[model samples]
Target: MADTYKFRIDHHGSLIRPAEVLNARARHAAGELDDAGLRAVEDEAISESARQQRKLRMSVVTDGEFRREDFRGAVLDTVGGFRRTGGTDKYGRAQWVADGEVKAGGPLIADGYDGVKAMAGTAAPKAGLPSPAFLAATCFDREISGAAYKSPVELGEALARIIRDEIELLISRGIRLVQLNNFRYASYLFSRGGQPLTLDEAIAVDSIAVDLTAKPEDVRIGLCPTHQVTGTVDRDAATRLFAGLPVDRWVLPYDKGAEGEADLLRAVPADRDAALGIVDPATAELEDVETIMQRMDAAAELKDIENIAVSPSAGFADTAGRAAISADDQRRKLIHVETIARMCWGNEL
Candidate 1:
């Protein structure tokens, strides 16, 4: 396990401001702002986001994704060769989902350096990549078959190239810790009647991308299961699957009031440092520190205290127009993190 303490926030800004940003970009591109003017706005937004990170006192900050047009939809749109088809959401909203076979786009990097520079103002800024599951859910349909690519592997390799390019771009921009967000990893295990890859196969696929993009010391892999407290993340299985890989950190969902929380803690391997998600980022419900302390105490007995860090279960909740957390709530959360950090590194528990 790593000896030095570390912490991170879930990447959720895209979810927070997707509609507004996307629509704004569309309008800008449609002549609300000339090309030079639009670029200036993007630059300003990136700079402001970095300043905000410094104010938050976060060790690592993301670009706030102000440059992204859509959090989930843009990746699919960028990858060429997909046919758009009409689909209905569970709520019966008319939605368009990408289908049909497609050729992968060659490696393309984000054009904005202003955002990267802004995030690097004080704390280290790391670039983030969307997980394959998030990409696949939004873009790839199992029904689509391509003559150019016989399997998802062919397509995935192309996607991996683009991901690698993005990582390298971040490194070039002076960011060290690149986080790959793959929320769909475990969800595939429960897919009914789908040709999803097995656990070993999925690990292999992840390994390919990781190997291509990151040096052994420069990256951290962040995995999120689809649902909170799923009983499918086996520590021994993951240990075997990830053995000898240059993994620096591991993250998993730790939802409040979930039965799988205890099981998830038990499954975390003790050899690698872990981010124990205590707050749920998708909900507005504030966490009680006493409850979090109790959970951490239980988890500490399962995994070594030295191997843990405290953070929210995922990124901030996507609730629209939600009020920011109160200063007292923020202080309590920070106190919980500090207490955990002290216990882990200072042995002061």
Candidate 2:
């Protein structure tokens, strides 16, 4: 049988000073840094990030995503052959990007995967592979004749193809867990009329991705409602949609609290597990132990108590340093990690 539960943390996997790298790259491209100097800086940052992950005892360490200049916006920028085009949005005229004009394919991962494998091989943890969160808070839509692809079936298939390549690469490296970051799924659901997708449409999109990337016995799928959405998870809907799928796990947003836990308890089958985000990743405050216990207690009432993992709502640190939290913030974050570990492991709370 699959493990009942597991706990892990997301290491940003990006260099500590991403903005500096970007600025330097822009300068280098603009004839500032010499080629040798730029290469030295890149190598140094990559080395440092690996060292930091080991120091932090992070089980599933990422490559600090240093290779990519921007975590959220870089996909559009770095994917070879893609070009930015003007498009309209709810606000007004906007810039829309796509890959057709530049190339018929997506980003190649062979080199990037090799780099991660080399780094991970040296600092191999219990979990030997890195969890690359793809498609986080973004949608893959193309314009044909000046119209965005809005049909769920068409869009989902296109996304599935891209995601499939990523899965194949990770699997090639013998990685077991592949987390596809899909905040856009929830965003689309809550936009405007509050239900951009019907029940069938949502199920279709999710199931297609899961089927393409994972075998019925091998994969764990994570989902979260966008911040714009309110209320608990749609338990009945989730149960219906995910039933008989390979989704062995579910991860919900932290703020959903007791009601959200209950919803997951009902939605996830007894055989599967749930990952609860007890601490908010957006802030530096440590989660109160007493409060987490109450929430876990509520979850225990509904599902197997052993099947719970504690973690943050998203990655520990944001790619954009706008938050500017300090070292003290990381200390508090560690406290939340400890609290969840004790609870999930059934130690005294």
Candidate 3:
């Protein structure tokens, strides 16, 4: 074991939970439980999730985003000018859609850190939100947003201010780590959903979104450049994205197709750290420590092992039932990550 390493499960922005919390949410919707009744259960659920993370011996613990449904929509819900379609998809999930003029809303992170921190105990408390880029790209309607702002860029700046305000809240509450999830950047690059901006445009907007000043080193900022670069990694685009980002830690998505992406290490800003995602989050496939070591070895070819951290390629419960893995599987995955951190970085075997 190398005895010193950094590991985070990734800010999934949601947590897999026991049936109690799930049932509470459903009942609250059905009017079977009052708001207080529902919130009590949510508190319990967040505490339990923190317990699980601590049990796994994680030095840093989060509330598992147990309070959010769609991480993206949750942030939008805090901002004014959007509504959830009363209609549900065939999947029955309530879709929060943007159909109104965007208005200045209340502080988005208000009381969020207080609650998550209250339950996390002595473990380092962490919290994250869906990125500002994801918010603007997915929620800002051209006709609707145009009515409220001079231009899309103006709306984007509004979002950056809101997010920075949220970061200030997190810092003030003594919360150390904050993550902004930005997988859509990768999705837009590879998938049919056109990216919200050109690569250069995105780099610019993203820099604004990520800009923050924490009072202390313990209050670190991180970002996840989601795992959507399909087939093979686009070295030029991906490198530019990483290099341009100013986060202290860069959470990169590299799972099944990561072999060709080893050069990603070469692109990581030397001043910024990396949490290399080596495990598959979309499948229940168990990665033996050897498999992780092989990926680590590949990364070592480009940068020293000390230069990187380790985690699941993504959060296990990012989209709620989307990853399709059992909760036990997530536990095992965390164990695998923690175990490998020890073997590879804790000390010599």
Tell me the TM-score of each prediction against the true structure.
0.75, 0.72, 0.87
* Global Cα lDDT for candidate 1: 0.53
Q: Candidate 3's residue-wise lDDT over 9-97, tens digit each?
A: 33334556567877887888899999899878878777777777777766567777666665564476567767775766553556654
- lDDT (tens digit, per residue) of candidate 2 on 212-284: 5344344344444332235445555556644644455566654446454465456667776666666665666
Candidate RMSDs in order: 4.7, 5.3, 3.6
Stretches of candidate 2 off by over 4 Å are 1-43, 69-82, 85-95, 99-110, 113-152, 187-199, 212-229, 255-258, 317-319, 346-349
> How many pairs of residues collide in each model?
3, 4, 9
What residue runs in model 3 are displaced by over 4 Å at the alpha carbon? 1-13, 85-105, 114-122, 187-193, 321-323, 347-349
Ranking according to TM-score, highest score first: 3, 1, 2
Which candidate wins on TM-score? 3
Model 2: colliding residue pairs: 13-64, 13-65, 14-64, 81-102
> What value does the lDDT take at residue 33 in candidate 2?
91
Q: Evaluate candidate 3 by giving its C-alpha RMSD to the native, one decimal.
A: 3.6
Question: Where's the lowest-lDDT run of ten residues in candidate 2?
Answer: 125-134
lDDT of each: 0.53, 0.48, 0.66
Looking at model 3, report the run of 10 residues with the lowest lDDT sum. 1-10
- How many angstroms is residue 135 displaced in model 2 relative to the true structure, after the best TM-score fit? 6.6
**TM-score for model 3?**
0.87
